[model samples]
Structure formats: C-alpha cells, structure tokens
Target: MHAWIIWLPVCEAGRTFGMDSLGGWMFWIVCVCFSVWENAALKVNMRESSLEVVRGDSVILPCSFYTSSRLSTLNIIWTLARSSSPETPIQVIVYDYGQVIEDPSLIGRVAFTGLPLSADIILNYTRLSDAGTYRCMVNNLPEKADPGIGELELSVLEPPSLPDCKWDGDINLGGSVRLSCSVAEGVPTPDIRWEKVNPEEIPLPINMEGDFSGSVQIVNVSSQTSGLYRCSATNIL
Candidate 1:
C-alpha cells in the first residue's frame, strides 16, 4: 500500500508566538566605560542596552548623563550606523552652542527630548528600516573631558498577518502532490516552512511547480505520505 501525509497548522502559538501586535521593546544601553572616559564625578547613566519594539510604533530610547559642575558650551551628537554599512555613520541630530542642527534625512523622524547637559533622544514611528544601532556622544569642551559614548540596539518586529497551506491536486500513490504555504505580512522578513506530523511514514521533499516560498513537491508517493501536513509562519526577531 502507498502512503502520504496531510499536515494541518492549527496551533495558536504559530499565529502569535513572539509578536502580539502590541510589541514590547526592551531598551538597553551598552556602557563604553563611562567612568573611565569622563571624570568619576561626571558620567553617563544609561538604563538599557537593547530594545524590542513593534513596527509602526514610536519608542523612547532612555538615556541621561551625570555632571558635577556647570559647563560653558556642550556638544551633543546622535548617530546611527546600520550593520550592513558600519563604516559610514548617519548623523541623525546634533546640538552645539545652544544651536540645534538635525540631519535633513531624519528631520521629523528624530527629536531631542532631553536637555543638552543630559542627552535623551526619541525616535518617532519606527519601522523595519529603523532597526539598527544608535550612539549618543557628549563633549563638554570647557572641561576637556573624554566623550561619553553610549550604544543602544533596537529591534522591530511584526506578527505574520496571514498564513495558509493548501494542496495542489489529488493525493494519490505513485502520483505527485504539491503543498504551497505563504504569509501575508511579516516585518524584517518572515520564514515559511512545511512539516509532517506523523513520523511513521515520511515523504521526500522535491522541487515542486512553484517559484515562491513554502513550496515543496513530493514525487512517487508511497503509503508513507499519509499524515498531517502543516505550514508555519514566523519572523526571527
């Protein structure tokens, strides 16, 4: 007797495992030896080094500084450098001599929520493109102190909007059956895969008649391919 399996993706976890629409961003800041760079009396106080946020939402990257005495002039600069091209850092915003200069590329998208003495920045309406590393540096020219540089990482995520699995044609022994799966939406890219629940009979994965993802062809079916066929959608945020 020939065998074939049918997979059904009927788990709620697959729908909403890591992402829940209302995303949670874990904000963190990696200290670049604040105590050593600046005077022990004056340093930067960062709350978090990493954060996770949902797409289409605004997140406040928490950051502040500690100062011992007042300074004449302060220079604050915020920069972002994507992993793809780390050498060239994009100047997001800058504050100097009581004057503010925001990069045209991020005119309305970025803002300096905190004062010059204590630097804090807020990113508005973040998307997958905004996911990258951020740096905040302050230079108290009068004090001649080392620049206080803090690093923060941001991750944007979105749940798979629509996921489905369907059979191409009749599932017959010695014939061919194609299963194609796909998802409607996923940020930072979504992964789609096919699986068979029952292990007693396993079918071979072949190149089916589809040029898209979540597509696999099983040729020369035997009694082994008679089980549950399932498709799962998820983003590795």
Candidate 2:
C-alpha cells in the first residue's frame, strides 16, 4: 500500500511538469511574435509621419513618435517629395537625427521648433506656384511607427490698385452725364464716392454697383453746373 501511494504521487508530479513545459514554450513563442510585430509596426509608423509645404507662405508640419521610453534616441527626418513622383526629389527640407540637416532650398525657410513627441515644423514665404502635395517622411525610428503628412494649398493674389475713371456718357449742356468710378481687384471691396464742386453745391445723384462701380449724374446741366466733378475710390487694404 505504501509503494502504491508513492507511485500515484510521482505520476501526478510528472503530469504537472509536462503541462508547465508546454505552457512555457507557448509563452516564449508568443513573446517572440509580439516583438517582431511591434518592430514592423514602428517602422511603418515612422514612414507615415513625414510631410510637405508650399512656396509663398508658412506651413507647420508635425513629426512625432510614440514608442518605448528607452528608444528615444531615434532620429527624425523631413523631406519634400514631389507629388506623384517619388523618385524625382525636390529637396530635403529637414533631417534631424541628433542635429538638423541643412539644405539650400530650405535655407531660412524651414524650422523645426517643437518637442520630439510633437514636432512643429514651420515653413515660411509660401508661393502660388508651390501648390502641390508634399510627403513628410520620418525614418530610422521603430517599426509600427507612422510618419505624419500634411498637404498645403497656396494662392497668390496681387493687391488691388486705383483704377482709372472715365466718363461713360457724353457730358453735354442741359443733359445728364454719368461719371463712373471704379477700382479693380480688391478683397474687401473698395469704396466709391462722387463729389460735385459747383456753385449750387448740391449732392449729385449717386448710384452704386456692387461696391466697386459707382455712377453720379448731374441733372439740368447749365453754366452754373460747369464745375469739376471728382470720383474717389479707396481700397480696403
């Protein structure tokens, strides 16, 4: 009976060891798979964070990373890849590994002025011809890391100037004449006003058209109405 009890306990111990061995192997396999997956994911994430900018104005593109705190030694890069053509490169705007990479096209134009986790890149003096999609790339980071991308749309507008005023109708005696005042190409629209310098000093009949065009008519033209008519236009900055 003593030998029988001892054999039963030995059998139970063997079974427990076998199960534990299997569990340990499975755990190791899972850990290895997760490590590989995490590296790949970080690589992808770094590639996704890269971005671009326009020519005439300023643009801020963010490039950041999220990974284990121990991997903070990773590098960051920002490049301007031409739209639709990745092989033909325009310029490397910024490449910040431990320090910043200086490129001629981005001289005094690009700046990286934010923390590593939240990078704020500023590009100034954007132009209309610089309108295109840009690719911002962050490289040499961990796998599964995605780089940031930004698209900029730039528009250039020439400021409005004072337009020439001319008499649209014949200025005749005893007949009404229409003097039109106009200004071209303003954002907020220009102000138009007409002033009559005559003996009567009466306000001329003024009709405005869409903030830019204005017409003033002098009725019952006489020698007394023979005075200088002035049309003034002021643009809104």
User: What is residue 147's positional error in candidate 1, in angstroms?
Assistant: 5.0
The Cα RMSD of model 1 versus the native structure comes to 27.1
Cα lDDT of model 1 by residue, 42-115, tens digit: 45656789898898788887767765456557777888886657778888888887888888977787787867
**Local lDDT at 191 for model 1:** 63
The C-alpha local distance difference test score for the whole of candidate 1 amounts to 0.68
Give the Å error, residue 166, model 1.
7.5
Alpha-carbon shift of residue 116 in model 2 (angstroms): 2.6
Across 1-237, the per-residue lDDT of candidate 2 in tens digits comes to 011111112246455444444666666766776776565533223233333332344766544545553444545555554444546656545545557764677678777776455444666785433334455554444443443343332233334457667775555777876677777754435667777755544566679877678887767777777787777666434
RMSD of each: 27.1, 10.5
Best by TM-score: 1
Please give each candidate's TM-score.
Answer: 0.63, 0.44
